[model samples]
Target: MIIEGVKLMFVGMTTVLLFLSLMILLIQFVSFLTRDATARELEAIQKERELQSLKRKKKKEASADSDEDIAVIAAAIAAFEAERFART
Candidate 1:
């Protein structure tokens, strides 16, 4: 009788384990399906952000070049003004 009970217990445990493993696999599959679309969307957003960063960098470079040019012009004007003052 004890042997029979042990066998029955083993069978029950085996069945429970199998069912649990199956459930875990199902859950993982469903999660993958749900997140796959979101993952693609996140990738697209990341690409857009990188593109925006590049554009900002270009703009900053352009502004810096313009600022340098303006400084050169201002310095030239200042020198011209000093020369006129000395002449007067």
Candidate 2:
């Protein structure tokens, strides 16, 4: 009975090892087949990120310009009110 148990354990371990090795080999093969496609996809993703960053920078610059415009308008309005009050 002890011998039978040892044999069973050996067979089970060997089977598991073989299955894991085969799975690793299959994954490597698939990756090898798709390597070029994956590289292109990575490049596309990087380009998209760069474009998004540029868009964000442009938006920030535009908002900064608008903030300056708003400040100038506010100053003009304040000057006009002060002049009117002085005349009154």
Candidate 3:
């Protein structure tokens, strides 16, 4: 009985190892076939990311410029109010 169990375990382990090795080989073969397509997809994704980053940067710069303009306008208004109060 002990010998039978050991033989069963060995067979099961060997079968599992064989299946895993074949799966690995199949994956390698598929990857080799699709390598060019995968590279193109990666390049396109990178370009899209770069464009999005550039758009975000431009938006940030515009927001900063607007903040400066608002500060200038507020300063002008404050000066006008001070002058008016002084005249009164």
- TM-score of candidate 1 to 2 decimals: 0.54
Judging by TM-score, tell me the better candidate of 1 and 3: 3
Badly placed stretches (over 4 Å) of model 3 are: none
- In model 1, the worst 10-residue window by lDDT is 31-40
lDDT of 2: 1.00
Candidate 1 per-residue lDDT, tens place, 32-58, comes to: 888978899999999999999999999
| Residue 25 shift from truth in candidate 1, angstroms | 11
List, residue by residue over 1-81, the lDDT tens digit for candidate 2. Answer: 999999999999999999999999999999999999999999999999999999999999999999999999999999999
TM-score (all chains, Cα) for each model: 0.54, 0.94, 0.85
RMSD of each: 5.2, 0.9, 1.5
10, model 2: CA deviation in Å?
0.6
Q: Best candidate per TM-score, number?
A: 2
Q: Predict model 1's lDDT versus the native.
A: 0.98
By summed lDDT, the worst window of 10 consecutive residues in model 3 runs over: 50-59
